[model samples]
Target: MEFGLSEDQVMLQETIRRFVADEASLDTIRAIADQESGAQNVLDEKIAALGLDGLLVPEPEGGSGLGVLDAILVQECFGYGLVPSRFLANTVAAYAFGASGSELAGNIASGAAKFGLVLNDVVSRRDSSGIQVSGTSVTGKSLMAINVRDATHLLFYSDDAIHCGAPDETSVVKTIDRTREFFEVAVAGADPDAKTADVEQVFAVASVLIASDTLGAAQAMLDKAVVYASEREQFGRVIGSFQAVKHLCAEMAAKLEPCRALLWHAAHAIDENDDEAITMAYLAKAHMSDVATFIARTSTEVHGGMGFTDLVGLHYWFKRIGVNRQLFGTPMVLRERAARQQGLVA
Candidate 1:
């Protein structure tokens, strides 16, 4: 079978690329990052205006009704631009609600509600943290909750079930990447009526999307490094003329290029409900984490001292890739999960 993105998918990719270039320039991203609150709302409105919030919702319920592969394409553009929005969290919540046959799926489709996702517990649980669900109520704290400040509801897993409720309070969790918001959310006696979707499947979708984001960010770093190498001079010669620099750029491309195909297959597996979808997602996430880190480090080295400077702004993409590496599951965690799934480990 011929395996590639269809014509429409290519167009969708291009369209989003154009949108990112026009709206999410470094200056705009910097301004948003400087704000103390609602930093993501600026870009979120623009995404909503473009109707991207409906990217994963079913058409019958007023959405584009696209699949995970298409969502991956959009996410790649967002990552490339370092756009700060809740597209990742919202997409996962939509999938969870739709899969569970919940009425809230309509609200997500119409962009009437936004959701913060607490998925860290799905991978590694913390004894001192995590929410607990009781009869129609959820109470406790969830750390590293995505998009909590603006979320109308919180989607989390507890006691082997999916729960959604309003957040009673939120406190920001500072990290190296200020481009996106992470929070410690507190919920008390809130609704716990969300229907359950397949937990593994929801996590698989999240892993794939996060990996796609890293792929885009790494691609951007590689592109920038190549551009810098061509123009930056050293001892009356462009850095690109040096064999060592040439090897570095080549190695980055060699490693990062194949990640696109890896992510494509993983996303396709999820959409098709293939037997290997879960394992593929874990593998893709793990592989991208390793490759993206290498690219980020090598690309910065190519820029010499300037890569670390704010004027060059390479750190933004560098930090974006850094954060993506840890989200959902780190490389170590994901590889262990993949091995267990394949019966290769106890």
Candidate 2:
């Protein structure tokens, strides 16, 4: 069976790659890193123009009605650019709602609203007064939410359902990654009755998209490291000619390139609703998380002192991959999940 991307998919990836290369370069990422509200109107406009905002929405919802594979492609490009936008939250929410056949899914696909997702596992129950969500709010403290300020609605998961609420941004954490922003939102209450029974599917979608993003960043870093090694000369010749530098660059490729196939398999499995989709997605994420972390380190080490400096701008990709690795659980945790699926562990 052919595993490579189709012509259209390849074109789509190329188009977004060009857009990121030209419009959302490292310099642009650096400029927006320090903002309190990381909402970029122009970035959103550009994405909307391409109809990327509607990529995962079903056809009846006024979207392109694409599948997980398409979204994964664009997200990978977003990773390569290291562009700080609300794309992840937007796409994931659309995927969740659309996949579950929710009415709210229609609105999002039509570009009527944007969303932010806080991946906290909240407990919920129905009570005499109404639906209640525990740990949704406590002394105005909540888990860190990505793109909370940019979202019109805040989504939280509880009891296999998704609840929507407005955000109270009293305090937002200064996370390690400057290219992206996160907020610990204080919500009034997440309506437990809002939406139900596919939170696991949504989390699966989120995990693959994130893994694709890290893969992109890792690829970019490897490319930069290889180019630099080939150009930068030492006492006698270019550093890449040396065994150590060549090995570092080669190892990065060996680790990162194979990861693309796993990501592709995971995305395809999800779209096909294959039996192994969940386990495959987890495997892709676990493998990429570890690979990305290693590539980030090796890529930087390849650059020598320049890698650590902001002038080279490699740190943006470095930190971005690091952040992605932490999200959706660590490599070891995800590996354990994957292993248990195959009856490899107790």
Least accurate 10 contiguous residues by lDDT in model 1 = 188-197
lDDT of 1 by residue, 1-346 (tens): 8899999999999999999999899888887778745545667788888887677888777778899999999999999988877788889888887755666777887877888888888777678788887787677787888878768887787777667787788899888887888888887554545757588888899899999999989999999999999999999999999999999999999998899999999999999999989999999999999999999999999999999999989999999898888888899999988898889999
Candidate 2 stretches greater than 4 Å from native: 36-39, 120-141, 191-193, 339-346
| Model 2 TM-score on a 0 to 1 scale | 0.90
Q: Model 1 segments beyond 4 Å from truth? A: 36-39, 189-193
Give the whole-model CA lDDT for all candidates, comma-separated. Answer: 0.86, 0.78
User: How do the residues 68-170 of candidate 2 rate in per-residue lDDT, one tens digit apiece?
Assistant: 8988999999999887666777788887677667666777776667787776342111232122366444223455568776577767664456667666553
- Given candidate 2, what's the lDDT at residue 78? 91
Residue 98 of model 2, lDDT score: 77
RMSD per model, one decimal: 1.5, 4.1
Best-matching candidate per TM-score = 1
